[model samples]
Target: MTTRIDRASAGLPPAAPVRAVHLGLGGFHRSHQAWYTAASPEWGIAAYTFRNTELPRALEQQEGAYTLLVPGAPEATEAIGSISRAHPGADRASWSRDLACPDVAVLTLTVTEAAYAAPERDADSATGRLLAGLRERFRTSGAPIALVPCDNVPDNGAVLRSVLRAATRDDLRFSGWLEEQVSIASTVVDRITPAPTPRDVREVLDTTGLRDEAPVVAEPFSEWLISGDFPAGRPPWELRGARFVDDVGVYQQRKLWFLNGAHTLLAYAGLARGHRTVREAVGDDVLVEMVQAWWQTASRHIPIDAAELAEYRRRLIERFAAPGLRHELAQIAEGGSQKIPARWLPVLRAERAAGRLPEPLVRGLAAWVAHLRVGEVRDPRAAELVGSARAADPVRRTLSALGPDAGADDELVSAVGAELATLAKAGN
Candidate 1:
């Protein structure tokens, strides 16, 4: 008997190239980056998950292919031609052998924001994993490649080196080889593809009954901005509408402030108002206002203009309202400890340094902290910061978990604590 997934293949297509190898195989990778890579005939990316090999195992059984459904005004459909190869990254000993391929130009990463920091961080951080492989290439094959990080950090390439090469500080030769052979690029990736629902499962299956392991459902919008260096080489992602800039920080800020920042607002406030999905929360005028307030407070500092921000919010509302997409607040709010410092507090610091604390932003911070206290919240980063998050001193706790700079001012900490007190009982 065919499973529900296998029995529902209506419009699936064949596989594409296998030039690219991805480290973190998640839904976002399939929906956003892989979709773009599939659009081009020359670029084929192989993906690997961490220890959970369900994605790779399923797709490989289907010959390294999958589907991407765009939930839009009419809901568009197409067979992606992007991924052609995939495996698990925990198979590191063997997988590292494949990295020796000179043509595999971009080693792209979408590992969650939490994974950015070095374990037990200090002046000397973790960069050995990167150094070891690149060093092998320099010594044996003289091949070079670009190490691209597709996460949401400020300077992702810089962070990757700081953690990967600087972690131990024991090997100078490996560090020198990494400097000579490797190129770390920062990329801003954007797309709002939600997790698959039962309806989506049914929608993907047709008369063909073809099952896919990693079918992605998303909004029609997508964007990617790459910077740093593409030493080995890169595909012409520009052909498919990707922007290549020298300073991806501007683009990163654009996506982070508008897309991710707004996502946090909808996740925290929207849920408090009894919304499960972003669409349901944003559809309500009240929840919409909350997000608007968030954007307004954050808008004061982003590089873009108010008009542009307004336009972005309008599109975001439309995407949220689309019943076809079912983005989960639980998922968005999963990494508060990891994301708050880099995503929310940066704007907070910016706004505060200029002498004005945005009320809505402050409210958001409070809500997130309170949510952590509720004990039902499923934030993994919260688990990582268990001790600090529970402390009576909100600023001390927040700064300790988030970073050193997060607790700079007593007034700011107290204000966040006060707002959190108001919203403590609320849950959406």
Candidate 2:
């Protein structure tokens, strides 16, 4: 017999008042933020998808209750009851209303790096619509709210502020009000939640006996570090393993350079070696060596202590090698333009300044160039960069992706060129 998840069926209390509005209602948010908010049952979430209506509709159908499958030797399924409403990104009226509500103290976002692009002409963009919602709320409530961005970007709160300010350049009143009323909380979020496969859906049904249409699957590990002022109160997320600190910058950099940088290496270099998923790629000796080299370079720059960094890297290996998680290399490889500057180029520049070529970084850049050359990419800047990736001279092509300073540096250029040649010979 099949069961459905809801307040009545699950024997849980009714959904709480809408205290938080979440942008980008994807699997990561479900597994990470929603899971955290579940600890504070009084602070319900009204989540909106990023231009995707299917998840919104499906979650709404289930009364915002869905199975969260945590993968391990024996995967466990738990029904999450933190969401009060599910909405499509285009539902501007509802978004505005929710934001205007005085009780809605916090707005959390996971709308990826691309959504924050200063796209003024595109009114449908997440940034544009968020500006609209903020404008609407400012007029009605004049209330303080926290904007916690859970994207992978460094200083994400500041990034969100910059994007919103750019989007609202014409409206100084809205911009000023945003400065006065909104507090952007920078966050470092880590979780590996792959898009659910059909097998996962079947497994959820079999385990929970629930016909969940919008189930989310995640690895066993999750971490959240947040730092900022929240004038409007936030959920007691600290109770749920979230660290609220005075500074998230160090943690943010650690995550970006170590975890994210390693992922970028695996995505490009690992995929070049014909591995499709992070698990398979991470288990490879050569790929592991490449990641280790990159980590050695990255660790030199990140301010975390040696023991903590070592522990983090060790945990990363265990997490990445988890056989049940199928995090795709192609998925990680997406948005290389936005991702590389944050993940790799900084380490490359730091290493170069310290008089080191950084072999893993050079090869990673080469892998990205080769990956671009191999086929079509999904990046917004793909057309502009791919042609450059296929340029005749390796240095010229590498410079195009990395920029003019790296181009002007003789040592760095030579290393990049040599790596590109080596990769070419290897047929990557």
Candidate 3:
């Protein structure tokens, strides 16, 4: 019989003081940041689940300890004990109190790219809620703290600061305090943590001999590179293979243009070709060629050494082809409009400026447009853009979704149009 996991069952000491608060309490956090924090036994995380309350409820029931199932040559299950408490995302009182509490020194976020939209004024937005909490902290304790954004967006720290500044522009004192007291840290995070399957849940019981209602499954690989100061203090994350660097741009660009860009391409192009996961899509010759073309074009801009990039590419192939991961295309396909600007547009413009029409970039954009043309799009701007895709010419729709320059470039438009035609012929 499997025993339910809790602090008592696990024979844990009294919960550590909550020194860190995390937004978007999802699988990636369990596999990555929380795992890192678990290395620092003194620091406990008050993790808030995003949108849904079920995970938080389940985790709270388990006393914030759950199993982490890592699939590898020999799969392993380990209990993570970093989370001191789990709260619903809508717990404004708890969120505000945590931010103001002197003990909470770091605030980490994993809300995806879509949450940052119109962050300046939307008091109800994720960023807005963050600002509200920050305001409370400033008023109550005036404590120094770091806000780390662990998202795929480029220069995520800078982007978040700009949004916070815009949101607090009217209050000079608050904005001044923000610049003086807050540290916005950018990060590059990589880990393949798929949504837990029913099989995974049963396996947790069988393998760990514990009934963990909210167990997370991830691949063995994990990486985190952060750049910024932690003013108040921080968990000793470096002990857990996390790199604290002065500049994260190099690593950030490499991840965005390579891993994330390729994922986007596979999400659209691969799904358009009848494949459902990265593993299946990558096995196809056409998709492989498309990925290679994208990497070659994007490699021109990455500042890293060629040898390192090559190794990274090889590792990527192995990671993407990991059958156990089963990363869903539809999950990666979400927020295309928000994602494309960061993933594909920079390389597209750079290639255009260098006097070449990059075929892979064109195809990726066309695939996105084609994706919009077919099914219900899962994006904040979906209503406007999907209608535009249906109402306008294919090339025009591509340009409208991307930018004016894409429309003006005759060669680019022609290339994108050709890709659209090919996708149409494929009945995608």
Candidate 4:
């Protein structure tokens, strides 16, 4: 079952000193972003996982090469030659040490919503980890690296800057130091990427006959919209259908509203309905209708026109329905508290402000809060979070416990509470 890489599968690896450095080197980043880089052999990317040694061990053993499969009924792996090295994030000594090298120009991050999560700016939860990471990158060495945050937070570059500013310890010199160097770029990345399961590994092995210890599998569709500057340069991803626009906000709004917002809906409602994967949930007629209804309302407000929105919607439906993509309910549920504010709150706030409260969106929010009551899922890293949960009103309880934003008036709170009560009594 151990097959040497098909030399024809991926072209010759590009010449030395890796051009890009990726953080949070999980399966999704491999299948999605790395796949983009692999399409062009020139941009050899050396990536690292966040504090996980196994990824480094796997990559180095393979000589910085692995299989990336486009997930489907019959999975197929394409040999990738982009990665030249891998390391663990906690090994910041090496992590920081690598960034200083002049060859590394672009840095991409896929550290999940929790990394950039600040549910409410006013709350004590906000910190400038991304900012600090960049400032430190500059402080360690004045090497100009493009800080591309692949995480999906609103105005992500701005958020990155704000956090770095916040973490400067109220020190003007440090703030000045930050302002002088570093180009914190923002990007909106899309792909129906799911964590690989044993079944997935089996398929990759069976079809490709490649003994890939760490293969990344995702659906065919993918996108990356970069809004910030790439001072030190970046991958020519646009050649392979990526759009490098002046403002990715319109695109982001279209996506964040339907794609991500719909995901939140399915995660909670789909879980309640006994559907496990996002694909499974969207497949059910009842749930699909709910998704459609929710999207119709939200899409109307998207910055894009009707024709473009319609096409995006169509593409979204097809992407969600990708049977090969096993986007887990639990993975979607990972940082509910962290993600709720950025993806869900804006829609809720806009609707309420317009005097039209979106019931489905409210249901999605309630379902997430209801998940807190179950306690079957455990995020050990988030041990500090679960302990502090409290509630006066169910709405107040959920928001208050979330560590940010008491959000709107009593009317909205009651609406959320009523929905939560319905969900609780419905016993899903």
Specify the highest-lDDT model's number. 3
Candidate 1: regions farther than 4 A off: 1-17, 72-75, 119-132, 164-172, 207-209, 384-396, 403-408, 425-428
Per-model TM-score, in order, reads 0.87, 0.94, 0.96, 0.87
Q: Give the TM-score of candidate 4.
A: 0.87
Provide the clash count, candidate 1. Answer: 18
Residue 418 in candidate 1, Cα distance off native in Å: 2.9
Query: Residue 251 deviation, candidate 1, in Å?
Result: 1.6
Alpha-carbon RMSD of each model? 3.6, 2.0, 1.6, 3.9
* Every candidate's lDDT: 0.70, 0.85, 0.87, 0.71
Give the top-scoring candidate (TM-score). 3
Give Cα distance to truth, residue 78, candidate 3, Å: 1.3
Q: Which lDDT tens digits does candidate 2 get at residues 166-212?
A: 77778888888888889999999999888888888988877777788
RMSD of 2: 2.0
Sort by lDDT, top down from the best: 3, 2, 4, 1
Per-residue alpha-carbon lDDT of candidate 4 for residues 197-274, written as tens digits (9 for 90 to 100): 888777777777777777777777778888777777777788767777788777777677788888878888888877
Q: Cα lDDT of model 1 overall?
A: 0.70
User: Which residue pairs does candidate 4 place in steric collision?
Assistant: 391-397
